[model samples]
Target: MSNKATLIRIAEAAGVSISTVDRVVNSRGGVSPDTEAKVLEWATRLNLDRRLFRSHLRTLRVAVMMQSPHNPFFEALRDAFSDLNLTMADLRITSFVHYIDVNDFAGTSRKIEQVAAGYDGLIVTCPNDPKISEALRRVSRKIPIVTLVTDLPDSGRIAYVGSNNRQTGRVAGELMGRFLGGEGGDILLVLGLQRMAGHEEREMGFRSVLRERFPSCRIVAALESGENRERAGQVVLDALREYPGIRGIYNVSAGNSAIVQAIGSLGLTHKIVLITHELTEARRQMLLDGALDAVIDQNPRLEAQRALEVLGRNFQRGESGTTGGEYTPFQIFIRENCPTISY
Candidate 1:
């Protein structure tokens, strides 16, 4: 088709003026994301020159927001985003990792609003706070938003890129039950904030599995570590003192190191069956050393890649073609099966 004919078709399909399509096609940068996505979808469908599409595409700045890197899991996620950023230059995609202090809900909400204004898209993993959800809903009106790791289903996000958190919890429960060798014993749950949907789902799943499948196993105590190492250790030590029969421990969020230390200080490392999430270096070492029996893990690198891909698809195909959640696969890591890697 002639250039003029192609322009006409795209303009008609996108319901924009030919001059608007011209600006978008030539990368003059006056179009909104929604309109640009429409034009690009039409251009792709009409088989417009691939070179033109690729060479003239606008640069997309994506902000990846998560908790502070003090937590090993969030630190790994930050690294994943940084590493992936180097390889997505061909797509003209630039990702910036932004840390939010989940401990301060109001501050986190304000930070999200500020970051949203500066980026074309966002990938966030935050607590399900009312203020944060409201901020996300407000910013989503102007730019695409994808929830990562944890999900806020009602927060106006285009998609959630992560594993099935509930299933992860269920798997952890099964492992804990089986590792206890059929003799039911007290189990302790050390979890992150209850406001994080992912953590909540995991706790519920873990509890349900124990109740239905392993009736002999009882959750003697549930502690909120708030992802703090010192706090995790203190709470866990206290719980152990209170519930001496606790034979299994599930670390749902972070602070694996603290949990290990607590168990070791009490000389209960050999007696407790410990399972946690994320196979970070510290956790891997613990697993190998018999401090932890198993880990319910997910790939942060893959999740980061998929989050960016989801944003890219939304930018290219518009809301009609791209708006859904993706469940990244989770793995069970034992000392024998865990891969040896620097990460």
Candidate 2:
């Protein structure tokens, strides 16, 4: 039989798709040893050309596991990935989208465990709990894993693709400190969700920088807004009422619109330098309208491109070195350099 015919026959006998057979032949991802042995035995029995077989066996599959598709930032990322053109003969990219409540550890963990069996590589936003970390570790035994946006410090993930959250925090803190014109006034730290590792790191970095550089500015209180605009607005309103001297605000997560509304309600426009992350549509408008002073943006396009490149490299060479367990730089954005939003 011809080489392709032999491969197809072996794949049929193994009860797996041709792509799975290709993966086994190339050692790109995980396949059962029995399946691998069967394919190898068939190749030997058929005396298929080793060089020809290796040359023709080229296909890679990767899974991208993320949070809600409803979020514009993640939606942008998804669109970016779909737009990638890794036009190579041996590479086939497939993305699997999963939506889990960012705050639900158990639910996320269950989903991870469920999907861990089928994928060759994983790109995921790490949940802020040990259970999810443990689940990732369990899966890494079989396939390479990469963390996206957020990180799991203890998980044996191969690389991370996201911003240097601490630096982002420090940048926000510096902007707030300078814009507030000193450390004597009160500032509120608003977070979208404390369970997100990205938010947690940003908060830490912001607080660390503020404490060291601007000790006079007290962080009056922090409240979680759960990424809800209404909740965020309400939280800021409550904080404003509770701490009447609030002069500045640092948002380490989403829900910036609500914060802006609360500030406008109090008529603090241009009076306080507001700093946040992710230059979404509302944030860009607010900055343009002079309601927001600065924003720390992690380039979603670059992040998405890097993610696809990492996966592509892994599929091509079975390895990647993008993440070295150090803080990656978070891009700083103001009204001046914010990239124009397409949709």
Report lDDT per candidate.
Answer: 0.87, 0.74
Please report how far candidate 1 places residue 89 from its true position, in Å.
2.0
Q: What is the lDDT of residue 149 in candidate 2?
A: 84
lDDT of 1 by residue, 129-160 (tens): 99999999898888989999899988889999
- Predicted candidate 2 versus true structure: per-residue lDDT over 1-343, tens digit per residue: 5657766876776678888778877778687777776666555444455554554443456677787766668777777666653432234556665667777888888888788677777878856788999998888777777787888766668777788877788888888888776545898999888888888888998899888988888899988988766888899888988988888888776677878888789877677668887777878888788788887777666776576666665654445434554334566677787667733
**Runs of candidate 1 exceeding 4 Å displacement:** 1-49, 320-322
Error of 1 at 335 (Å): 1.5
In terms of TM-score, the best-performing candidate is: 1
Off by over 4 Å in 2: 1-55, 85-91, 320-329, 337-343
TM-score for each model: 0.88, 0.79
Residue 63 alpha-carbon offset, candidate 1, angstroms: 1.1
